[model samples]
Target chain A: MTSRGVRHDSMRARNLAVVLAAIHRSGPHTRAALAERTGLTKTTVSSLVADLLEAGAVTEGGAVRGGERGRPGVAVRLSGRRVAALGLEVNIDYLAACVVDLTRTVRLRRTVRADNRNSDPALVLTGLRDLVKETVAQAEAEGLRIAGGALAVPGTVEDGVLRNAPHLGWRDVRVADLVELPFAVDNEANLAALGELWFGCRDADFLYVSGEIGIGAGLVVAGEVFRGTFGLAGELGHVVVAGDGPACRCGGRGCLEVYAGQDALLGALPSVSELVDRLKAGDRQAMETCERAGRALGVALTSAVHLLDPGRIVLGGIYEPLFPWVAGPVAEVLEARLAPMRGAPPSVVVSRIGGDAAVLGAAGLVIQQVIAEPGRMLGL
Target chain B: MTSRGVRHDSMRARNLAVVLAAIHRSGPHTRAALAERTGLTKTTVSSLVADLLEAGAVTEGGAVRGGERGRPGVAVRLSGRRVAALGLEVNIDYLAACVVDLTRTVRLRRTVRADNRNSDPALVLTGLRDLVKETVAQAEAEGLRIAGGALAVPGTVEDGVLRNAPHLGWRDVRVADLVELPFAVDNEANLAALGELWFGCRDADFLYVSGEIGIGAGLVVAGEVFRGTFGLAGELGHVVVAGDGPACRCGGRGCLEVYAGQDALLGALPSVSELVDRLKAGDRQAMETCERAGRALGVALTSAVHLLDPGRIVLGGIYEPLFPWVAGPVAEVLEARLAPMRGAPPSVVVSRIGGDAAVLGAAGLVIQQVIAEPGRMLGL
Candidate 1:
């Protein structure tokens, strides 16, 4: 083929991806809306949509009757078939795998209990492979085919090596090789931020704090997770809150995690789920513990606010339910502490995705990779 | 002009600006180097440089001698003529102004002690205007022509309004109107981060925490200040370190600043500068205070590291002296807290700019704006 032909084909593919991404983000919109959103000409949008329709990547929904028009406007939506991606979220004590379709819907999911605190990379990989196999099989049964997958771990991963996974006790494990899929691995907190950016806030500057066995945060700026140079930007649990406080797993004392994370709470009380359940059931002790955690978290969030000035903060992970128990104390601490900006503090919210944030974010990584332009892929 | 002619002219102007920026950054490189750096043709660089020289915006230096010479290669450098930018730094008890040439050299400087604390917008503006005029006069005497200026303020500046300047005791002041110079204003910490990114670190991922009367941090991620959505970020001092510690100016108790900031130390011991001087003279009590401040600052830096994963933390302002005095304890705290990575903890360093960080950064903002696009009057 001629070089010009190759260039034209790449441009067409890029425009098609833009159209697909827009639809995936906004669900279904008219051709005019798609053109406007993607900044593509009508002719370009039409050509791309026609190609997608032929490839079964998108399908036409029936005409809408709302608008005043000489001709009815037809809606285009991502087809439920043809392409799908998988997400794997490996926590300290559990594993979650999900199959997501082109429309950004989870078609299949499976969760399994697994202890990854033994520092054995093999154990985590075994759990991951099993989870992926189970979820993919379920998706296959449901007639959803998976094209690729990505995993989210609560530690630093660089060049496919799991350099640190405090919760899993895994260090320097070859993540990509272990997963054995055309996949990418990212820090869990980073994914949580992306999860909220994609599905929760969509257009809000957000800080997503993933509180589990260890605590961490993800900063979403301008609708994207701000991953720092080394992929370890969200390790907030280790931020020293108490200078001479108790030593943390990361060796820092009086860190927010030492005060508010799952391990700290579990060490102080019974299992986290028990306390959370009791807190939800209005147990005074549980409520007080939640409040204390919230206060510590509030202090951290205040710092987060002072640093990034995000619009809102999204509390996610297993600790999200503690928002009600902790929000008041956190808000109180924030109001008392923050340089009052016109009498209001930044809003703090709970993650809408509940426990599915990391896995969904992992899935999003695949989608972003598949659709991103070469210029963006260069990591600039 | 015809529509096509106008469009062509706009493209030419943009390309010329690109060429100029490349030369300004890389400095005195051969035509090949400029073309390689800017992805422009050697012919384009030659043409644009000629135009710029003719316009008196640029001047060529002596010939670049040394490479296999058939026709001698000519070197180029900024003439430091045509226009000058002013930078104003507002300190708690003083104001500093500097005039920088297009070649990025400080041609003139003037500092005056002013009661900026508790000053109104008009007072601050008047002070800044007088300082600017003085500096402008100084620059003109030195044969430098003034063009525009930027002010560095220690508060959240939104639409030219100072939301709050606690040290200055100013609130909701229209800073832009007050300082009637063709200028822009931003948080001092952000500007410091920009300065460090541009001139100091250059390639280092660092956090610049301004430890003046209040505590603020500027995050440099991938060689740029990672300003959050509303441009308010890097507020490390407010991170609640002690839940029930001393009250802070921000109305919060037990903030990092309450333990580590200037006012906090002064309130605890009184005669802060005297104490610092005594410590320099090897007074044990004064050394203890500095050490305690370092510990608190270290705790805050831990949180920043967790959140940013910066390669280094550049402490600026009056905090510079504390680096050596506090480095041991801070490193101890960080080592105790950071995640067990294969490598050592991120390096913490004091900024080279010392007390002049804000003014240098303010000047840097204008330099960045002009250098980014030489043809533009200034950056917005």
Candidate 2:
């Protein structure tokens, strides 16, 4: 073993990652700032920066101004443009894609209308392939190189096969084979949760619910996405809310989706978009529909809160307009039911990324996968 | 620096403990059997066994005469009687004490009436001290030695303090200071979950619901109890089931416990013991009460299943009497409500330990704390 044993090597990698990640996260910094932020020795930080620059993972920019008279320090910054990534968000009606740089900044974005009717694996494959091509083309036109991408599918995908997508009426679609890029596929809700963790609700452990035609949820625990065994956790909308209520497409009855999902609210009204317009126009009927949906959502939130005790619930979906109407009643219902030790009722917040939470989450997945060196990112 | 780096030493200790734990769990085993069971090299197993024996953690036993002609091999087993652990189960009306061996076998058990009025820090401390003394006396009279003990309180406990005991109406009772033994304290539900994992179900990811005066739950995920931030996980009974329904002692309305807890069931009946007695006697009113409780439980279970996707649920406490009467309906309701992909409605099973599940769980807490090496119990 080199002077540093394999054990020491792992430690070194972790320490290096911490320093580099700090620089990458906080922008250019002097050695002293890095040490203060990362709690690493000056010698260790300097050594890690040298290695990162040698590997072309980081670059030194202009020297710092107004520093001590000893030496003008180089402002070390991450070489973000040196690497590229792709992020794909799959929805029931459309596919959204983004090209992100190493610094996690989106360089290019594109979208394609998707027909989710085709349960045929080949059709789904073709749709994904065409979308990737379009995304890559958009990135190239914007002068950004492509490295790898991640696909966020609105279904349970295990071992590259989409096990179920109730809204899309799709099953067993081979996600990896469909996309030619080095890609990772995960549940859209889980990705949305990661997006919330990475860019939206930092340091929050809560539930992210995507209430579209089909409802799904992502659980964030301690600032990380919590994917249970088989990656099928956080399907909150599928949980039965009414014992003898309506039937769900997934063959369950009284599911949260059957009560509060996008289709359910729309079915209660004339049209979904029309209902949104009415709510915007201060129509009482639309407001009542949203209130009923909120009550059902409150019921489901009670379950989520009881089971996991998340700190908050971030609402994401086509029905984002209903959030304002529903938030207060949902909180009231939750606080009215929760146990005393459970802190206070969790806040019900709307998605910070608006319609792009899933795409941003998908992009986060690519960054996580490509920058596999967590040890190198955090100076342990 | 200390022969092995801190991290590497932790890894080695963890690996060694894994082998030892495997042998300890499965009982006396030959070197080859331990190696096979623990997935460790035979040489590594031998070395580990030697270390354990030298450390007096294990003792040699007679060989199991095999059918083969290979030389008779000695078996190594944890010297259960050589080390002792204690468990204290503190309920609202009673205290149960248990002395367990190193191998997690309960050797002595005793109980005494307790009351919430005695929940003052000094009184609780004195009472627990007396109980531990009496239990240790019993063990000593039986020629057994004591090492350590743990207290399992029916409340939220943190840092050896009882943060909240709703049934006892006590808050922040510093328990470790009161007990005159090497002792630790945790929420009873968490202890019950550990008990189920170690002794009852043994690695099954099941929810253990205690439905006595009040309802509480413990979550076992991938064979480990999931203690949420502040150890408030598995507080399912407190999750609101019927919004705007009834006022709870916890100052919440419409909690699951308010709908299905023992007090809730008893309030619907004549008395607590009468409900159990009538259920046993097949009284129609008691049976109907149980069925209603089961339905409410099924609703909560449906929510939990959607959130956690555990493999099964182990029902305990006062709810156990309802187990035979309610299991069918609960299963039927859960099956009817759950989506198939959540993995065939998690089997609803009765706790094997029945009324003693809590006390046994308390014993499990002690065994987990005193006997097992620290590193092997990762993710606890």
| Highest DockQ model number | 1
User: Candidate 2 has which clashing residue pairs, if any?
Assistant: A15-A379, A15-A380, A17-A376, A17-A377, A17-A378, A18-A377, A18-A378, A18-A379, A19-A379
lDDT of 1 by residue, A1-380 (tens): 00111123344555666777687766787887777787666777787788778766679986564668676668998777755678888886778887777667777777887776765777668767877777777787777656668888878888777787755767778878645456788888888777777667665477888887778788887667787768777777766565667776666567788778886666556776777778768887777777778887877777667666777778887567777777788778777666454257777778888778898888877766644531233111
TM-score of chain B of 2: 0.88
Candidate 2 docks at the CAPRI level of acceptable
Candidate 1, residue A30: the lDDT equals: 81
- Candidate 2: lDDT over CA atoms? 0.72
DockQ of each: 0.34, 0.28
lDDT, residue B175, candidate 1 = 70
Residue A81 lDDT in candidate 1: 77
